[model samples]
Target: MAYLYNTGYSSGENYAFLEAKGLCSYIPLHGTYKGGPDGFKYHKADDCYTCPQGKVIPFKKVFFEKKNHTKKKEYRALKPVCVDCPIRSACLGKSAQEKKFTVTFYREGYERNNARVNSPRGSYMKGKGQSTVEPVLGTLTQFLGLRKINTIGIDQANKVMHLSAIAYNLKKYLKFTAKTVKSDTKAVCYVILNIKTLITLQIRLLTSS
Candidate 1:
């Protein structure tokens, strides 16, 4: 959901990014048309759509769902367009009528939705970029001695990147272990004034008294 904008690139660009992500799925906007109508179409009514050339592309059918499950959406070009499209040779991989594309959405809704929830605060938060995020990661590699790797292949790369990020966040979190108020805490420290009254009451007198 974070509005990270950039010119769309190839699947190779996606390969690099996918290596550095966890619980994320690719959502391709659209592939290159090799100079056609030069725009796009959105069928909001259906939470599905078509391309600029009127090729109907259904959005992921589920619209919303639990993680790890991908919805398949299909697209097919009109016969007329397919027959007459000058760039059809490059635009449609195979025959235009038989060609279709799929869209996978919401694989990492937990993090992506963070943007939507904060969007009301305006694009200021959105403007903050790698200058802020990457340096923190560097601190992890430098001071925490987490630098270097011993892995090969795309799968290992993806797993390492995800695990590294988790380690960084957990290290940052350790600095606040003495926190007095944290809903994210897994244990109650009521006697030390770090726990809520309701939780304390449950722990002390609920079944005991």
Candidate 2:
């Protein structure tokens, strides 16, 4: 199965989790996600990132980020290497001794999911969802008196939603039946008018003969 979500739920952990469960995710990447620093090239074989100056910043270790509690991989370059570099100020802030950064442990999964999200199929899915699903949600929230479920408990909320769905369906059905009946009535009237004209023509012919 595939799931579609907004950028709010876009994260490396979420992508990894979905892939682990054999599900495809079509969520766009978050705004804060930069993939990696600019002017850096990642070498898969070495498992390292090469800076614009052709310096390799090897992978240091994997650790859990305290704030978000997500697994991340650390990479750092030697202090001596950054000391004399022309772009030292730009690459590393004045307080830092060396160039260091961390990326999500599930970076590979993130890349795969991001690629899928940017593909043609992803665009199609997004359009289909907006056209087919969003309007119903809008109607429910705006016109169907379902802006809020005042009922307490999940069971009650479920019942309310079901009733709302039933009402929408009934409205559609009634409109369709009404149109069908009106068309049938018009067709019958047309046939009767034609028959009356034919009979009047026959009488005129008999009288003239």
Candidate 3:
């Protein structure tokens, strides 16, 4: 089975693509944390979230995020309740209306990703990456002029990255090809000698007979 190892750059689209390719990915969420905020806790039974100050924010509506094309559930507190609350200043300062928060409607994918990342195997993979891939990337950036891309637009950046990867792989390919050719030559000679010895033995037996 194939696995994709990456940092936080992986998006929902990336995850979907990997799934389509039948490969599992070990990537942290784009953001440090999911859900609304530190103060808000989701209540599944009531289908609402309880704020730090014990105020309930009920579900308002479900909508799709246009950018990622993912369904989201929007929750909000009543304008009157928020307006009169003592902690309104601390919760949502200078707001004339109610407080609002949104969470993904299809959360199974995220939860599954979280579980994979928190597992023992995931931790080992992360540590291995830190010791191997991260250092190589660091070296490339520090010495190979990959620290910053002085280009604009995603297309240009992608082109530059492809060119860089080509150059890097070409160097490795040259080194690998030389060694492989040498080993192959030695193996060919060894097989040819064995064949010659077998032929000579057969000729001797025929002559003796």
Candidate 4:
């Protein structure tokens, strides 16, 4: 199955999981996602990042962030390397330690997903979602009183959603039928007016003769 999601659902781990499950995902990266630091080159085989100053920042360890519980790989350059480097001030910005950074463990999956997101097929899928899915969702949330489900169980929520969809479809059908009837009424009025005009013209002609 294929899934199309917006930037809100974009994540390296999510991409990796979807790929592992043999599902296609077309999701745009969030605005804050930079993938990696600018001017840094990642070496896949070496499992390291090369700084702009040609120094290697090797992978140190994989750890989970306590606050967000995200798994990340830490890379750190040698302390001595940063201490004597000519651009140490510019690179580290008055820091007391070596160059250190953490990247998502699923960086490869992120790269692959990003590549697909920029492809033509992905663009088409995104456009299709905007035209077909997003508007309906907006209507449901904004107009159909589905912004929040007050029910207690999944079944109740599902029923509420079904009722909202039915209401939306019924509204659309009523609008279509209303327009059809309005046009039919105008047509009938137009024909009667023309007949009356013709009869009036005939009466005038006979009286004048």
Most accurate candidate by TM-score: 4
lDDT scores in order: 0.46, 0.80, 0.71, 0.79
For residue 198, model 2's alpha carbon misses the true position, in angstroms, by: 48
lDDT of 1 by residue, 1-209 (tens): 33343224323234336445642322232344221123545454765455656656554343422474433234444466466656567766674554345444322332233333245433454345446654766786788666776688766665666656655655555446536456544423322344344345544442353
- Backbone clash pairs for candidate 3 read none
Summarize candidate 4's per-residue lDDT along 95-209 as a digit string, tens digits.
5589988888888887788888889988888899999989989998888768899988876676666667656765555555556555856655555554565556545544553
C-alpha RMSD for every candidate: 13.1, 15.5, 12.5, 15.5
lDDT of 4 at 59: 93
Clashes of 2: 0
Which of the predicted structures, 2 or 3, would earn the higher lDDT when compared with the native?
2
TM of each candidate vs. truth: 0.35, 0.74, 0.56, 0.79
TM-score ranking, best first: 4, 2, 3, 1
Q: Score candidate 1 by lDDT.
A: 0.46
Candidate 3 regions exceeding 4 Å error are 13-23, 66-70, 127-209
Poorest lDDT segment (10 consecutive residues) of candidate 4:
200-209
**Model 2 TM-score, all chains together:** 0.74
Compose the digit string of candidate 3's lDDT tens values, residues 1-209. 53546655555556667767887777877665476668788887888888887888999998989996877889988887686788788788675478888887745556667677789877887887889778767756886879899889876676666656655554454555556556756655554554565546545544553
